[model samples]
Target: MRTPLFLLLAASAALAQTPRPGVNYDEAKVGSDPLPDLKLTTAEEWTQKRRPEILKLFEDNVYGKTPAGIGAPKFEVTATKTDALGGLATRKFIHISLPDRPAWPGMDVMLYTPNNVKAAPCFVGLSFGGNHAVSTEPDVPLSTRWMRESKEKNIVEHHATEATRGTESSRWPLEMILKRGFAVATAYYGDIEPDHADGWKEGLRAAVSKEGANTVWKDGEWGAIGAWAWGLSRIADYLQTDPQVDGRHLAVIGHSRLGKTSLWAGAQDERFGIVISNDSGEGGAALMRRDFGETTAIITKAFPHWFTPTYKSFAGNAAACPVDAHMLIALAAPRPIYIASAGEDHWADQKGEFLSGKFASPVYALFGKKGVGVEEQPAIDTPVGDFVGYHNRTGKHDVTDYDWTQYLNFAARHWAK
Candidate 1:
């Protein structure tokens, strides 16, 4: 039977009005409440009082509070190669472990510093692939840890293989970074913990828990993201001791989930002079209040292990959540941060990421710093802002050389000045 034209049109309208999973794109539906004001007048007030309060809100409700008394990480320089990368850079491998918590499998960090520069500024980040995947060098050990299975990424049977080597080299760009006089320090995310629901059982979280593998996570306990961030700080700890690297000028950077990790790490550790987020939509740079692509509900359900159980409560009711991504950006304050989004990556909500920086501008103003200066989101490919940098790159979800160019320029501006 043929349907009438008007009835068909009416049905189409009804279907359009219905919301689908991961398709929350309406701007009108975004949460309208004003972001929690940085009500204090002085920088001291913001720093001494409100900053800590906001930090705790994220820790307690979102990422979970990092348990204290884990004690200092013990660092061992496993390898040093001054003639690495054909003598263009010096490479060192540092194995970091907790003395008291020997059950926890610690991470191995890879460092590359430009041989031409002494105490070169460094970029510290976590990689989805192991260090062997970042460089083509055969000597870089293949990570034997549990990895998520992906045939395309060459991670087979939850393990990294020969095919995985240099799979992610395009993202690292160690030569380009070294030529620009910046050091790169990175570790595999799985080294700290495998990225899965039961990752905690074999990760640092379990090692610290009194019950070991039998530990049941509490509502506000730290999750995978917290553990990864803690690992970044440990890299910072080792970088500070390396004469070839400028630890004081370190930048903590990550992409996707790791981008969220970098933001949380930068917020807690003031040593990261710059924080960069690439396509870290939703729980990373995007404001949760905006029911855009990837909502709190979507992320929480898909990867509940990434955040505190408390965060799951605000799944559909994001406005009720005590903190927003703007507050997370605000925590960076006077320090320079670069938030990047991809043009085709709607799943991460490009506009929501831009608005995060815009809303965070007032907090930056408190410290006499500027943020994304425009009133509206800039056109695609147009980068904006000062102390708080942002750009919607002309690509898909992954990071690329275009993104690296902006980062190198942004870091040079602040680091050189």
Candidate 2:
């Protein structure tokens, strides 16, 4: 498609227009909203009708059930070298290997929990770098995995440095998780897939492409977000078998690119009991039809590898697409889904994201839950309701302790059962 055509279909999403333009975040109308009859009269309906349909919606639109990254990844325990911030005892480290191939080999992961505790609920997140980058808690294991875009060569070769790790700690708030009795599980997203034009040249897509033709990744099989979500399922796979994990309360979480992945993971795999999205913007939580800032065109061009080639066509012509963000949010129906946005981050479309939660509410109501507690967007700090919830933090396009506290509270209200 030509560049102008790309803008014609999706440029409205990434603009910096004042007071927001092109689309209305409130009661915004789009192509069409299928699955509108969501009023659950009985509990049985929630389990059989509402919940399953939501999952199907997510599969068809976003993740499409990407299989977990394959092969026995080279696993290691590196948590012994440090202290868990907030006085919590924990183990942290890196898991290295080109599980499929070494093009984008090496993964650094950090795990925090009460030492040796069994059946603990865990929160999983995707980070930007090697394990050592996540925290200075001497408890945070130094990473050994090969990271591309690095200056030094290691056993894995050309990997990112410990300095590059945990650079986005503002989004993680591990100390908050440690104090809450919840385990924080994280891995560098690049280990699963790189964020570049030809990233598929490395990671699981290349690995899975060799043997599993039936997996269907070609059209839009596994973008960086898809790969990260797939990793969440693998984490779930590992958690299910681990003694310390509760398995029932696994919360797949992410911010920005990772935020988009979190929604896809929670929707595709029921294994993730809760999903939290922070400034997921275009593909994360905002209503695609709203055509707000960071439209389909902007994301596709800026990060071509983020989705499938088929995705680029919808750039400006988003109305032609079968689904919108509401449908994506709906896919996680009945499962507690929390979306956070920053008031100043218009690029992320806080209003649009809130409306998506509002639009998807009817589907949730069908399952006997209030999807969005209110119709009109409320003040930034006012936390409200159950089921689908959204709140604008007093900040920018990042995650903070305030966001974590709300998420933990939301999870506590829903997942604590």
Candidate 3:
């Protein structure tokens, strides 16, 4: 049923692109031929090669023309608490209050750390459910936010809400993170006004009267992804002041659409030490050129608010867009960027994600860092790259322990302290 419509749209899209040839990346543009050697005889050349390339990549791909120039956020810790996880029963919850006023119902960050704190590198993420659902820990703060698809029918009465919390516990293993000396900090993605086009007028942008202020994203403007990514950046700003967190070694991670947010946040904010994109197919780590799974037309038609008004027109005309996933990835050059996918996740384009990583290599090579796994895509379970990483794990779209293992390994290599 839907397949024929997709074919017709794809056919027309291919026809439209036939008239004007786009960026000439057809030839294999690898190695030093296109990128002449910099004067790397001194330390200055190394910094120049590394930092500017990373910055430029962000400029072109991620938050096009946004301020990567803003100063780090000042975190004002308003509260703290602890709880124990299931195994060996050692985990805790620390609630942080962000420093932005009239409060605007500030984000709730629950930090899961090892019982013994020498401070470990954390794999932080934003989840659909609240922190309480991340683990079975009895003490983790019960979420106060409204969950959309919960059995809890009434939020105003608050009687039926007790059972509603901690229902999605299996997906988030906060206890597993703590036992391994890693801290997991998470916030409900919907705390910023349940991710829709219209509801955004009620969140941070409007609630605080911050509408139409001096910023890259304006009032009633930035979509759910941007708002979520912006929230993640604010979380990054909070992490810098924590003694329990090694902020210099933090890894920003997310799954599916949130995976897209992770990549965008990593690209926009340099404070994030590394990035992990799990099944972030289109508008993320997968190349638009491949058009394997999710297409620009589908994303635009369904989720109109996901991108700017300018982005919707490129639905069938994606080839006309100035950027591709590889270019989006180039935005994280020199920094350790990991693009992960599942073998069965056709909606996210497994092979196309691999291609995007491979395509971003020239930019990484500009700084002598390996970008993809190898010349060809490796079999599932094999991880690759010290700088830019890629792996196709066995299973479906959602993230797993296997995916987490690769990200930790990548983090260990980059943040070797």
Candidate 4:
């Protein structure tokens, strides 16, 4: 028996309008019990006492535990061009190799420092494609790593080709970054671990695990996001050694999944003085308990390798999770952090991101720093905050010139002092 077309259409419409339980869109619906009180009077006391507990909760349930004391890698400068980016910048391509692991693959680091500064504060993040894809510089090396092919982007056969160069130039804005008197450093995320579930076999995850050990990650064990965050820390290790880099002022920034990585990296590694998240959404800056767009069920099912096994248990039960996104933000207390959102990127939950910043304000206050100043979400493109910053720009899910403008301004305001 076929249902009437009118009835079916009406049913579809109703279904679309109906909101799912635990998945809230209305700001009024957002309510959670107060975060655990550490009972510390000073911010320094909170950092000494509560911070470790919060970090442990995230590691035990969310991004999983990364091993401590991962030794430094050997850095080799493969190519250096003093006259690059039309002589306004100097480009350096470096090879990073783990000790006694020749068979394990090494990663490449690309840097662009402004010629005018002896030591410049820099923005460091992982890039999606090869280094050559970030800029059109002829000297930048093409990546031989396993790449996801996109016919639209001109990548062919799961490999990067000449056509793939500078395909992601808009996201990078290298010349603009250099002109702002800040150096830029990036490495391919795949160099540390590929995005797929099986990619652990080919990357550092497997190499670092004990020989003959089960490579399969257990509950609370490190996942791909953990591995990528670990990789960024390694880059920081290298930057500290470079005379041309103002290591103390480095900002780690990323978009989408990499944005999540940036937050996690900033939380675990205090070497990053500033952290920025561009539409990081649920696992990045959005409050998970809001049960807003891009619910835990959707994320974990799509990217099983991104978080720990324990994380999956809280899929439909967000309240059951011990730590929410606000706690993650609090982990970076007292440090300058920025969270940006796109008006059209609902899957990333713009309002939820703002609320996370708001909830995190108390932790910042404990440290004698202000978080995002406004109680409500600010107007589009109107960035707000003191030590913590946030803005929801009018756009879809991607980085833009407007975003960079705000970032540069934020960095100058906080780090210039």
| Best by the lDDT measure | 1
Candidate 2: tens digits of C-alpha lDDT, residues 173-227: 6666766778878877767776555555656676666543233455535566777
Error of 1 at 91 (Å): 0.7
Clashes within 3 Å, all models in order: 0, 22, 2, 0
Indicate the TM-score of model 1. Answer: 0.94
RMSD of 2: 5.6
Comparing 2 with 4 on TM-score, the higher-scoring candidate is: 4
| lDDT value for model 1 | 0.89
* Model 1 agreement with the true structure over 259-304: per-residue lDDT tens digits: 9999999999999999999989888999888778778987797678
List the candidates' TM-scores in order. 0.94, 0.80, 0.77, 0.91
Ranking by TM-score: 1, 4, 2, 3
RMSD of each: 6.9, 5.6, 7.6, 5.9
Q: What does candidate 4's lDDT look like per residue over 1-417, in tens digits?
A: 855333442332233235445556776765464544434467767878788988999999999999765556899989899989889988998888888555458789998999999999999999988798998986688888877656656767667899889988899998899898999999999888876667778888778877513566789988889999988888888899888899988899999889999999999999999999998987889888776777788778767788988899988887778888888888888899999998877768899899889888888888778899889999988999988899999977889999999999999999878
Q: Residue 21 in candidate 2 has what lDDT?
A: 52
Candidate 1 residue spans exceeding 4 A from truth: 1-22
Q: What RMSD value applies to candidate 1? A: 6.9
Candidate 4 TM-score, true structure as reference: 0.91
Highest TM-score model number:
1
- Model 4 scores a C-alpha lDDT of 0.84
Ranking of models by lDDT: 1, 4, 2, 3
Candidate 3, 16-133: lDDT as tens digits: 2232233222224211212212223333454456446544533443333333323334454544544354333334343443344444466777766665766667777898667666
**Model 2: lDDT to the true structure:** 0.68
Q: Candidate 4 at 138: error in angstroms?
A: 2.4
